[model samples]
Target: MSSYEEIASPADLHADCQAVSHRLQEAAVRATRPAPSIHFDERRREVPKRGIEISEAAQRLANALHLHLD
Candidate 1:
């Protein structure tokens, strides 16, 4: 059997992987935190209105095209 060369020990490799994983987790959490300038409350309030507007537009288009949708 041929012998393999050593790069990093199993323990050392495990520690390095854990450190990298922790850093990635931290970065992901920071990225998802909302921006200061965005008005999330206002946007949430507008959701229903936007849905209604879209529905009205679709209905108007269907009427124009003479498509019978029950």
Candidate 2:
């Protein structure tokens, strides 16, 4: 038997084609429609201060490495 015979029937293929066509139509409609507008508040929110403390030995090592690179 050939691959064509593997398919159930022409009716099923027609139904699948119809479903794909419907999805394509829906996608086209969505593509044509304008995107929704996004609104941003003008006011800025305060952020908490954060700091990272490194050991003195690490800082000296980092400085030496930076000087070597330069």
Candidate 3:
């Protein structure tokens, strides 16, 4: 299947959730220590935001399909 299919799959959605959770956990651990470089901290914050955008897109797609796929 195509990359889009893989990403849109329920299985992959679950994997994305796990991956984001791992990233957040790692960021929390890093935050406990001294602050990293400015660039590093900036990229770190972007990670969760990207995940939220993806999740919102998925939700919107699901809602659209639910309304029109019948």
TM-score of each: 0.45, 0.47, 0.38
For model 3, name the residue pairs that clash.
Answer: none
Best candidate according to lDDT: 2
Alpha-carbon deviation at 11 in model 1, angstroms:
0.3
Which candidate do you rate higher for TM-score, 1 or 2?
2
**Cα deviation of 69 in candidate 1 (Å)?**
81
Instruction: Give me the runs in candidate 3 sitting further than 4 Å from their true place.
Output: 1-7, 34-70
TM-score of 3: 0.38
Per-residue alpha-carbon lDDT of candidate 1 for residues 1-70, written as tens digits (9 for 90 to 100): 4365657889999999999999999999999998776766656554444433347677788888997443
Q: Enumerate clash totals for all models, in the order shown.
A: 0, 0, 0
Provide the overall lDDT of each model, using Cα atoms, as 2-decimal numbers: 0.78, 0.79, 0.73
Worst 10 residues of 1 by lDDT: 45-54
Q: Sort by TM-score, best first.
A: 2, 1, 3
